[model samples]
Target: MDNMFVLGIMVVGAFLIQSALGFFQIKHFGNEYNELKAEGRVAIGKRAGKLTSGTIIMFLLDDEGVIVRGKKLQGTTILARFKPYDKFKGKYIGAITAEDSEMIAEIKITRNTVMNAVNNYKMFINGEAIPEKGSPFAELVKKIKNI
Candidate 1:
């Protein structure tokens, strides 16, 4: 019947359009991944000769015995070494260490406490711990709102 034929054609057309959209989405994600990798490499290079670790929750940058958070990370661990990837040559961005079991609990606790403080807007920035003026994040928000 003509109705059946038209329905079949419509179904096939819809399938093809969905397939194309999925393909484009994958391509876009791949491009974004590559860009992030490049930026990560650059950041690492600038901080080379320094010990660094990357986890799902945060990035640790250890330079001259000082440890600081470089990026927001999930899991915490001391990095054993770096492995160079073929795609990212000279970029020792990949960690070769097993996850630190001991630090896992601590990291989670810290993350939760920090999240709570942030959510409650109870974190301090400068000398004072007031609700508004003491938080750098609040200042940033105010500046953004003004802009």
Candidate 2:
């Protein structure tokens, strides 16, 4: 009983730490996002790797649709935090070719994520509803809703 009690306490303590760290990480992301939003239009893209590291990319755009700045966050843990990115700065959005994407992206996943951001910006300019890409569970829920 004593051992089990100690284990339970440890688990609870770990959970609390994780939750607190996650909250702070989210706050950091929000502050960065809001800062960019204040400067200009912001386009965001995300890749969720269920078992692997995930990535999120945000681009700050000018009125002419040029990328003014960028930020990226990637990791599997809450420790992941947004960092300044400038690869696409001064470049126009929605005009990256496959070759360009390959050259610019540090990895394949980042390449796809950047493309998603470009598409997001394009759709927003056209006044189209942003299409969502969700988990398998979310798809199942949508299917059930339609029925």
Candidate 3:
């Protein structure tokens, strides 16, 4: 086989594998989000990681802004799965304060992400902008534009 042809084949294989993995990741998020939605409104926060692991948090909130359940996923690889994040469960989103210790479990979600969730929920209640994905690409673009 020609060397260039072999390289092309390898690249295609990699792309296909990546796409399949991406699909699985989306499905995983969808399944969990739907489950949480079934219970109550879901508030989400995200932290995009460049060299480190990215983090995403989903909180199931009651109509009164109390957290009923939570999930967090943090990883650099496709194998990362959402884990139960019960730290703030049963706490009111408004009541969770800076005084609360920054305790995160094995998922490695940062306190900043939790604060983002709080801000997002507040914005939601106030009918402001909806929470959006903190994509690294968009951040990079913003940085470049600011420069």
Candidate 4:
């Protein structure tokens, strides 16, 4: 009879401990969830306005679309209307050819943003950034005068 009583006490103690552990685990998970939610909110709040623009000096493959950096053009259409030296004071630094080759450009970006995302892996030649998606050759040379 004493042995049975001891077993009953032991079983109750074990269940109590297990319940306490489960409650703690739930509390920990809730804290972690709140922290993650706060971080996401902060990140969204930090992204304010548009950054700078520049020719892409390099291309780094990422989940987002191709990034290009260069002398921060003042207007919003700079990326869409990017042409060979036409926008930068009529200075045709160089041109990207259809053939696979190297190129150069005056890459630019926002003061604090990641440079790789702005440059987008496109090699700059003669102060000119070239994107592999729009052109044929992957390379070109920047004119020394344009640089």
Model 4 earns a TM-score of 0.28
lDDT of 3 by residue, 61-122 (tens): 98898888899998898878999988898899977655576444433446777877888888
lDDT of 2 by residue, 76-112 (tens): 9999889898898888887865588544647877887
Better of 3 and 4 by TM-score: 3
lDDT for 113 (candidate 1): 30
Model 2 score (lDDT): 0.87
Give the residue spans of candidate 2 off by over 4 A: 101-105, 133-136, 139-147
TM-score of each: 0.30, 0.84, 0.86, 0.28
lDDT of each: 0.36, 0.87, 0.84, 0.32
Error of 2 at 2 (Å): 2.1
Query: What TM-score does candidate 2 get on C-alpha atoms?
Result: 0.84
Ranking by TM-score: 3, 2, 1, 4
lDDT of 1: 0.36
